[model samples]
Target: MENYHLTHEDGKYKLTKENGERASKVFESNKDEAIKSSKDFIQNQGGGSLKIHKNDGGFQEERTYPRANDPKKSKG
Candidate 1:
């Protein structure tokens, strides 16, 4: 599974793959758009994790695609 990251830089939001490799496009100033784009890319790749980061470089949240890969089981 690949890992995608959502981070803010230079007054804009960026979506990048592992090791800081640039993603397809740049999000000028919208974190929402960046998150959506990251999810779509992960879905297209079959499955992966989207890690959203705060402006301070701390992890905000992690969303897994396909659901099965999630480490914490959801109680029904």
Candidate 2:
């Protein structure tokens, strides 16, 4: 499975693949746009996980796309 992270670096908000040193995509606007873009990209890529960070560089939330019909995470 592909893992991606959205973070702010070099004055730009970027979406970078896990362990990648370079950004896969940079959002010139804001984190929200990057999030939307990441979601669509992940879905098209057959579902994956996205880790999003806030503007201040803090952990925000995570999203997991469904390649299957069931949720991949446990509630407990």
Best by TM-score: 2
Candidate 2: lDDT over CA atoms? 0.81
Q: Mind giving the per-residue lDDT tens digits that candidate 2 earns over 1-76?
A: 7889999887788988999998888888776777888888888888888889887889988778763633547551
Candidate 1 lDDT (Cα, whole model)?
0.79
Q: 26, model 1: CA deviation in Å?
A: 1.7
Deviation of model 2 at 49, angstroms: 0.4
Q: Which parts of model 2 have CA positions greater than 4 angstroms off?
A: 67-76
How far is 58's C-alpha from truth in model 1 (Å)?
A: 1.5
Q: Candidate 1 at 53: error in angstroms?
A: 0.2
Instruction: Show how many residue pairs clash in every candidate, following the order shown.
Output: 0, 0
CA lDDT of 46 in candidate 2?
A: 84
Residue 70, model 1, lDDT: 76
lDDT of candidate 1 over 27-72, digit per residue (tens): 8857887787777778888889888999888999888886787767
